[model samples]
Target: MTTNLPLPQFYSQILSTLQPIFDDTLPLSDPSTQSTLTSALDNLYLIQRMINSLGVFSENESIDEVGEKEIVFMSLNWVIGAAEEKGGLGGRDDRLSALQRAETAYTSYLEILNSYGVLSPEEQAESSAAASGQSSTPKDPAKKREAKIRQYKREKELRENIANSLPNQPESSSSPITFLLCLLPSTSNRPSVISASTGSTSVNQEDPDEVSKSTAILILRLLHTITIASLSSISMEMELLSNAPASIVPLSDRDPREVRREEEDNTWKLDRQPSKYKPRELISGNGRVLRPFTILPSTSDMSDRERLKSGVFKQSWRLPTMTIDEYLEEEQRRGNIITGGGQASYDAPTESELLELAAENDGSALAEEKAEQKRLKDENWARFADENKKGAGNTMNKG
Candidate 1:
């Protein structure tokens, strides 16, 4: 019962421009309205065709995977916006129940997006760390709140500054999209992603990449949902078959005991189960529960010696199977070699040893050395005296 899905061709940009007009003129079915509806449908079909070109199987995709695609989101947005048009799929006034059902389905889909948490601690810290070139893990509740506050303040200040710097002209508010763009956070680095901005909203595009990524993701998620809804019947049939027993296996042949055992095994246990031993609690001297001591790492701890000293570091790989005696023996051998097998003493040198060293120093043929020096000094003095006397005699002769 599978029909070949039609591939429509039209530019996304062109189709996007007509959305407002369609919304305004809906509930009417004149020639112009019909033509407009036809054109819009054509545009939607074209976009779907382009998306179908990717050959994605909705059944095989996880929600996250589908969410990451742009076209799926676009398709979903289109479905939500145009599904209730006068002559569209859920258009009949008499089929109000069907429209309500569709709305419920779409709302459920949106809940998935809405239920997403704000930037998680890890994500926020990672983004901050990437920007600041530091690892910032906030362990304390107060610090975590402070980090979030700081992030919000920083982003707000950045946006305000950018807004203030823009030319103060009437064109500043001319486009809702541009206004929204001006409202985007300054931390965003992608300004080119504004190409996907829909429904006459010209984004200020401070960060095109961020806008584009966000828009693309939104569109992809929508498309994924639309695709899923379209194929839900098929999916249900498959699911039923999977859960059904094979035609070859009759229900009567199954063992009742085995079925009962499986049922018992699959049953959930009670929350307060009986334990083999009573629970033990440590109490403080004052009678309160004794909580174990905990260390909360500070910024200084991350940047300083504490970080280096905190963790246990292994210098070598250890074989877990090695015996403690073997390790101790190896250590003893190394220790003996290093310390000279108890030959080295911690005691200081005695007076006797000091005196012995001094005596050895002077006793080493020292008398001969001193005598030689004295002899050299006397010979030099006698030579000088003889030269002086000769000089005196010469002077007397000259006179």
Candidate 2:
């Protein structure tokens, strides 16, 4: 008999409970917020169980990345909503405290994944054979050297494999919960400043579009920074693991029986020496080895939905909020700075200077008009002279 999966229902319930809370503004003290949070948390528990159970049927499946993403999204609502005084869990200080705990848990989970090592099937088989003592035992110095070299090669390969398996940004097949998580920060506190401006003290309180636009941009930036930091951290951890000493066996506790034998009858022996194997450079999937704390290129792209709304919100994204009179005064000041003299070296025009400038302009206009009239007079005189010359030529022909 085919068994039904509970994940779909779990997701549905989470959506149902969280959707209402997300859609409306309710007070933190309201009973509905608590009830909704409880429901969402319960559904999240189910989702976690389902994620854990993924490995049961698919041996090769690694749901670690997906599980981390799932839980992060599940926790974001609480993290964001719990701190809001209105329509949030803010009234209770304990819930706000819980947000910090949730953040710590998220960080710890990512760290665990970074540190965990998984051996491949081939490596596992080799290790099993060596542990069982079924492989050829080193009977000479050359054989011992060969064994050490082989082990080193295997370890290098393993490190390369692990490094290649870095986590990626969310894909299209990712749950809608990811987008919802992205929108969570809209409910969080607005920054004192959004776009940088020298004179602007705060964001425009009048424009809701501007507020939403700034909030969205902030969320995208936060996501980008977080993801880059996480990847860089994981890369550093891998590098450290690769460079760390393989073991710490003391010289006094040396086991003679386990040492390489040069002869079957123990007539000859070789000194035990460490392998001198140098590892190759570790590169990521993109062929770049990231240094510790190196900022990766931003993977977060604002969605199409955000782009559509940008026209409305970002219309004045950089513009400062001020009264009409203040705006006019600022503009006039800027004009004076630019036109009065370079770098505001000249003071504002006095009444006499303004009159002089007006007179100069009037005189220039009059001079141009007179020049045009003179040109027309010259043309008329020339036409009259030509007419007279033609009359004189006609009279001469008659004579």
Candidate 3:
């Protein structure tokens, strides 16, 4: 069933309902929340359809030229909602479907932004590369950082400008619905997505567009990871099952590490076994032995009455090869500590930073001294340069 209300009224009613839900005064798990949210989503979709049908925006028309940012803003919000909905869908089929939907929705959103001059040049290039399945070349870190900061400020302004322009019901007209002009959620209210690579939230966006785009990318990435993990688990289970019918198929040779881990896990199920090797027999008295006898040969002949006795004390430890000082001396000879790194080279002044700094601090004596030194250096270089022209060093040809 359609809302059947006028565009502004319908838009206002939906956003008004969404504000509390997004702000979290209304619990997501509450029975009423689902219907309300679903209705809002459906209406937002319908709003886009109606707006498209109105022909305010035409194919190949720039958003800037036509002043259709208000319509476009509503469209962006709808795209965000749609991507979020698909991303939140649970299970294998849902997860698989979500990525395609997210890609389509987000790609169109970015294309619109690119056309409107909202996206930076780098972002536009990246979007094009992504669409074409080509890799973008690496850019200077500083330039990329500067571009991101500019884009951040610009996007924020664009969002605010469009949001504030949302039409309100006229003062004369006593309509029940009023355009709530729902701004993007505060930073604290936005969900934090832990990055797979960095293990932190990559984009902490107050703007729903940024959040939705990041969330969609995350959803696709997570789907890939989940599929890989599930396949690995299934493979392991298959391997275990294959081993059960070993008579038909011999067990495959597994990695020693795998076998060791498996044995470790099943150690409790193993029976105790006797050691194959044992310590040598002590000289305990045995059957048929009249008296204790030494295993070593005697140095001198002795009478039968006399018996050899073993010494109680013998050194078991090895003698030291060298003293601590001798060891230290050897190590020093071998160069124990690394040395001689920064002593040979320093950060030489090859730029105009020194001149700029001296100009900035003209009142200081140090600055005056630096300025004098720089002047002398430049004067000497000038004299040398003027005396020896380019190619003057090629004396072999000259002579």
Among these predictions, the greatest lDDT belongs to: 3
Question: In model 3, what lDDT does residue 223 have?
Answer: 25
List model 1 lDDT by residue over 28-107, tens digit each: 54666656655655555555455557754354444445433232332333353344333332232323433444444334
Name the weakest run of 10 consecutive residues (lDDT summed) in model 2: 290-299
Global lDDT scores for all candidate models: 0.40, 0.39, 0.45
Ranking by TM-score: 3, 1, 2
User: Which candidate leads the pack in TM-score?
Assistant: 3
Q: Write the per-residue lDDT of candidate 2 for residues 1-399, one digit (tens) a residue.
A: 122534433353355445445445444457867766665665555554655666322334443433332333333333232222122244234433444444444343333222232233443343333323234335598987886577556444433332222121222222223333333222222222222224344422232222232233223223322322333343344356456555445555766664433234232111233333211222233546422112212224657676457436533222222334443444565453344465555566754454445555444876556555656666888999987874576755674
As for candidate 3, its clashing pairs are: none
lDDT comparison, 2 vs 3, better candidate = 3
Candidate 3's residue-wise lDDT over 1-399, tens digit each?
A: 576665654565565566566555677667677667666666767776776677655557654454422432424433443434423334444444444444455455545555554444555665565445343333788876775566456444433433233222112111111112322332333233333334455323334233233222222222222222233333344445445433322136667777777668543322233433221221122323232222332424544444223222322432222334544444556566465557363564444566757756868988887787778888999999999998889988874
Show the lowest summed lDDT stretch of 10 residues, model 3.
169-178
Q: Per lDDT, what order, best first? A: 3, 1, 2
- Which residue window of length 10 is worst by lDDT in model 1? 168-177
RMSD of 3: 32.8
